[model samples]
Target: MDSMGKYIRGYVRIRLESPAPERFFSLCVHNRIPLRNLTQEGSCYEMELSARDFLRLGRFRRKTNARIHILRKNGLPFFLHRAQKRKAFFLGILLGLVLLAICSFRIWDIQIAGNRYYTTPVLLETLSEWEISCGMAKRNVDCQKLMQKIRQTFPGIVWVSARLEGTCLIIDIKENDEIPQETPVKEDTRSCWDLTAPWDGTVVSIITRAGMPLVKPGDLCKKGDILVSGAVAILDNDSQIQRYEYVRSDADIVIETRFPYYDEFSRTITVKSYPGEQKTYPFFTLFGTDISWYHTPKNTSEIYRTERQLTLTPSFYLPVTVGEIITIPYEKKSYCYTPEEALELSQKHLQNFLKNLVSENAVILSRYIQIKLTANRCRSQGYITIQIPGSDKSAVTPKEFPDLSAETTE
Candidate 1:
């Protein structure tokens, strides 16, 4: 409270020269006038007092026969009195305060939450159409109405809420959990599928869930061969076969397979060699339009790289972007590699090929690599044996199954 009073009422340093300066100080204390940093400088007493108290000190000075002189004036009231004489400075200050007040009521940022399948751009576009975008007045937004509109526009969103947080608008959304019913085959359909071998391999393990296993462990199978049957035979009262019902087959089948890869590398190749000559082009972008500040190269063979820098306010709001394009000229040059270099290149190519061939579920059982060197080239052959999961589903063709009743009657 004392600090605030000093700021509002201002304070002054005064030097008192009198025969009885101590009497003046004692009178100030008795009248409850605050004084700070009181000191005596050889017949002259110096102290600080509030501007209001300084005005009331006239009577005390006459009674104590003291001469008081203000050495300095400080605080907001004194500053404002000095500023009143400068018209332009005072106008600038007033305009700045008005601008700040206007910015406080305007929205400068919009944020989204709980969105996955929908993109932020799409949601922002929707909000823009609804007049809820950045720079709009917060008082104009109706949160409940906007939430309803969002839920209606995006049917996948089950719930939505909009609220204002300071100068930003926050939108939260929730999506529906139910799966869409547009699949080609429904889970509850009478038509069934069978699990078949996707490649030629030996079955190492089989786990059946809803169908009879057609291939057991250690059985060799070919591509398109059914590992589990979708049809189950029902038994009759007399222990004879009755009828068959189709069901979806579910199972896991692991198989052992061998994959062979071969790669070759040449001893001679063409490479691009860059010259020292280069050119740069700088530009600025406002909104989405680019304004170039320098000339760009027209050569078709020029290699270039672009670097962009976006200009943003202290709050991280982007309003403009700057970029530079650096172009370097190059020429094609023919280079020949040594035998050792050719061998390394061939091995690197084979390693990349093997990485692509291997899958996450594959377990490497054995691997072998053979390198051959000719006069101008090196060749690498890789053989890898692995155990991988091999379960797949293929649609059963109707023609593959004949009418059993007709065959029995014939």
Candidate 2:
């Protein structure tokens, strides 16, 4: 049949004291020692010899005490031959692993450019949340899903791109343009109240850009108060005609706001006990799509959640991620209340409230012993003034009100 189980070809290695390995090989052949595979090793003769012929050779060298042993035997030469042939395969596998490692390290150093609104760190963090992270296989990542996630995370990034260059991932983004402001003209006398205050507050100081101010500093007025008027009925030297020009005013006002603080909490704890029970299943489907060759689950009073991913091939399936599960069980846990425990809980809640309120950049202007905690609710309000610089340009169009003509037809 094949090269396996052919003949019992025994190999012998001997050191001839008098002659060289070639001379010894000739002598062995002449003596009809049935030498088959022969070779030289330094001053020794390595050859394949049968048991009977080996005994005869040993008899000739009995006085000299020659060294000899079987190096190869008749059975199967497949293991050694196949092992020799697999060198390239093993080398390829090693190179593949090394390349993968290098790619993994290089992929982490992602750089982003053309990003005006979004920072690199912010985009990378968002990508990480969607599982499109470094070290993850490029084939497994979805480009469309990543783009959608980016838009969802930062709507300001109008357009962006995610691509790999050699090993680094790059993101490009563009931002939207800002809107321009508009101001009204104060040359029209009828437009006095038209140039009204933006909000209700006491007038601090006014800077008239092109028109005279009606309200001075320290003047308290409502929201609709007019600071600058556009109406100008001034007479011209040549003709007693009135002229109008645009005007702007900058004023600061005070306003009021309110904020509230409340706490509503619920908590529960339990101790669980387990009863050891187990069973094995020949096969099971994971992720509702993968078939597990074999699996077993232990019975315990625990709420367990398990997830796995498998790669299916034509003949067999391999596990991508297996044996990652956690159990959170409910138990008969009891809470004993003591004076110290109650005080601790109350103090902790108070501390949490203080920390939360102080962390909100809120300034506690004043607080009174509001005993009138009207079963309705406890409320807090604030009043502050902000200055809004008015625009110095006109917003009205140059086109005057068009005249309508009527035609009488017979």
Candidate 3:
């Protein structure tokens, strides 16, 4: 027992030795081979040779041509020559431990911002519906799908994002305020509500404060009808006086409008292959890092490669974006339009525009084309009277009126 630690352990394979079985056993036992473990396969003797006695045994057996290998000092596997297998296992374990520690300490608390209408509980519930929860793997979450779900549930939400920081989820949201939904009302006595016009006609309803109905249903009222009830009451010992107040008035007024339609009008309708205008991506760089993506033009003009690239860092992004870059050689192709083609294109464009306007509640009784031409640029002017069905209940009214009776000196 030479402390087996002081000596290196190795093996030798003696092949084609005559009287194989007896000779091999005799040599192994006499040489005092580290035969603590041994295996035999046909004529092969797998023996462990200690470093200290290996050289001496080699000299004693001159007939045997042996192979000697110096095992590297670092941990090596039992059967592998010059193998870093042990080191590999150790490194893998280390990495796995490190990852586990990180996961254990990661942020699991989520914070939400820019949420006024929706309480934290409500938003958290919505996120939970999307399978986005605290302690979940960040990379495993489908952000786009969650965003879509939020949009579906809350159509008033303009934008939303969810990210994991450590073990905490940071949810950011922006609400669309263009179409004013009902906001939380405060108990302010001075706050007043907006009063809009009712119908399109002459103003026959007038009331300063809350008291009585100033105009009836068929009272020839127009837009901006204020019917009896915005005046505040104050009681004195001898008299009662009207004061500032909040009021709303609904009125029905008759309106007379005219529209003229003509078969001829100057028209060069642009057949837009896309809707609206394409946005451009913003570009910025700082300290050799991109603060923003390079601004590029969207190739909406071309029929191919209209892709979108989202910015992942330096969050300021342009509303516009350019399409993908492409190289294509082509000559200009133009076509001439006949009168019928021009007229048809113009009619379609006008019809679509009118449809959109009507969808927004604009009344177009009739339209007339005073002039007609065929060019890229055309001017259109018409007289239109819109009849709004709501009345202005606001107590505040504009006092400025045009001086229609003044004579012009020029």
> Which residue runs does candidate 2 get wrong by more than 4 Å?
1-67, 70-195, 198-200, 230-241, 248-410
Model 3 worst lDDT window (10 residues): 310-319
Query: In order, what lDDT does every prediction score?
Result: 0.78, 0.49, 0.50
Clash numbers, per candidate: 0, 12, 33
Candidate 1: list runs displaced more than 4 Å: 2-11, 18-38, 48-69, 75-77, 85-87, 177-190, 234-242, 262-359, 370-381, 397-410
- 175-237 in candidate 1: lDDT tens per residue? 888887876765332567788988788999998898768889999999889998887667668
Which stretches of model 3 miss by more than 4 angstroms? 1-21, 29-60, 63-373, 378-388, 392-410
- TM-score for all models, in order of appearance: 0.66, 0.36, 0.37
Compare the candidates by TM-score and give the number of the best one.
1
**Residue 392 CA displacement from its true place in model 2, Å:** 15
Q: Residue 312: error of model 1 in Å?
A: 15
